[model samples]
Target: MGKQVVAESARRRRRPTKQGTVLTEAHIVETALRVLREHGSAGLTARRLGAALGADPSTLYRYFAGMDELTLAIGEELIGRALSGWLPGGDWREGLRELGLRIHGAYLAHPQAAVLTASRVSGRPREIEADEAILGVLRTAGFPDRAAVRIYHAFIDQTLAFAALDAASLALGRRARESDEERWESTYAKLPADSHPHIAATAGLLSARMKDSAYPAALDMLLHSAATQLAAARAADRGASGTSAR
Candidate 1:
């Protein structure tokens, strides 16, 4: 009896639900994202997804093994969007900068989904493609394997970290978001000069700047540091070659 039940479950997954609605993997992933955006991660369940899809909840298992697999699919979808129509240009730095921003923007565009999936490791095609692209950009620019891998790790992590952080803020309710934003002007901007001298002095700048995402500025600093490292590595290589020639 138990074996029959298991076999039946497997059969159910192989075919669409009795609803006669043909559900594609892409369709299910997209619907999952919509459910995530409208209702959030906690609200995403088999029953909720079924209603959204106009099919049985079990139909989702036909495409994905389970919810964890679905989450990875959602993450890959965001990465795919980041890579959509994007090609690396002549300037590696510029290419990397654009890639970083695209990734950041993609996550911010789907803040609710980002909050759930940004930290996930999908290891899926889209994610793998993105990794390969970043590494290729660094290696083609003359970075050694070690340096390229190191920079790639930092670059991807920093971009996703900021994406997740910014997305968390963006995912908040309107009033909550406003209240958090307002704290900069209402609290930090008004700090008394005597006790908090530095903040008071830069309060005006802080008020203006703190209202925006700092990812761009942070990305620039990272790129600049990478440029410096590349320059130093080249100089060292040249020095070693000159010594060998002597």
Candidate 2:
């Protein structure tokens, strides 16, 4: 604890930017996020971050050990934003549903940053709190410890995996993205029925649906499965209690 305090004190030493502004860890992280958004993932180099903050690149090392640490911090910032005003209602299924959506929305909001950080384990305070909050929702909703842990693992993994997958599509170059969109309509929709009967039969529907994300549908499936498990567990408990009474 003492070592952590000393390290944090050292990290927080205020430095002056080239633009005559003051630099803090928050400022650097925020600027890095903007850089990632505006310039794409590759643009998030130390030199670029330094230029964005109007400070030397080396100055960032004071707050972060390296680019990896900074990236983790950026990921944590996204998690923090996702949970900002979110409180779980008593309905466990709906609560998990909303939390999953909030996280997906927050990451999709910054595709480049999301692409960089979605698969990472931030292990920061916000990330830890988010995990605890989800587990708390499951436990309080009457799930046993083993079941709660299983569901919690599935919930977090599915949410983040979808976020990363969707964000990758969003992070594509403008021309590449346009090409992908065009192919769905001009190529896939126009395929000959004889050679690809199933796809051809559903081409109209598939083309219409391709533009939207699959995350919502996927999240609903997970929630439904969890609800089924909870109901089954309850039924099993009732059966056991009835037998004991007899």
Candidate 3:
């Protein structure tokens, strides 16, 4: 006991003090989240987080095993934000639509973090809740359990994929966007009046809707398609089961 005490004392004397030992995983994660929002994935390093926290970078290791673990925590935080204030009451359609929009909005709000965590598969806290919420809505809306689960899968897959896709698109340089825009304006907008009547008619509407309004509209359309597909599959299942019994 005396030897252990001396060793502890010597270690304490040699060890440099961190900015604050009261620091915790939550604080680290919250700090990292802010860094991610402001500086993006490349900026979210243990060194950077520690520098922001006024501590040695190694101080982060005391809370997290490594960068991957910290990133998983960050991912959970993002998903938790998506699930916040998300009441699943009332119409199931409204519930699913709101859930999707909330998740998409949460990711879009933190595009860097969204891109970092979107490709990772971590079944953390908010991930489970989001799944339960979507599955419950699909099931209650008359989808068979299996079909409900499938639709839930598609719903989340679409949310993350589209969020990342848009973030990536926005991150591309203005030159790329300008060139793409010029191409569209020159080629599509210049379509002959009768050759591409639909494009000519709705090009203005498309241009207007592309200014962020298209996201929610696209999500609504996706949800509607999934719901319709689920309903048809459910009916076919019932019909098959009845025929077998007969």
In candidate 2, what are the lDDT values of residues 1-246, reduced to their tens digit?
Answer: 111222656666475677877767778889999999999999999999999888888777877878888899999999999999899886888888888999999999999999999999979999999999999999999999999999899989999999998899989977888899888789998889999999999998898898888989989998899889999999999999999999
Residue range 194-228, candidate 1, lDDT tens digits: 99999999999998898789999999999999999
Superior candidate under TM-score, 1 versus 2: 2
Cα-based lDDT for every prediction: 0.89, 0.89, 0.75
**CA shift at 63, candidate 2, in angstroms?**
0.6
The all-Cα superposition gives candidate 1 an RMSD in Å to the true structure of 3.6
- Over 109-188, each residue of candidate 3 has an lDDT whose tens digit, in order, gives 77777788887777887777777778888887888788777778878888888888776655454588567656556677
Model 3's C-alpha root-mean-square deviation from the true structure amounts to 6.4
TM-score of each: 0.92, 0.93, 0.77
Better of 2 and 3 by TM-score: 2
Model 3: per-residue Cα lDDT at residue 158: 83
**Pick by TM-score: 1 or 3, better one:** 1
Clashing pairs in 2: none
Model 1 regions more than 4 Å off:
1-21
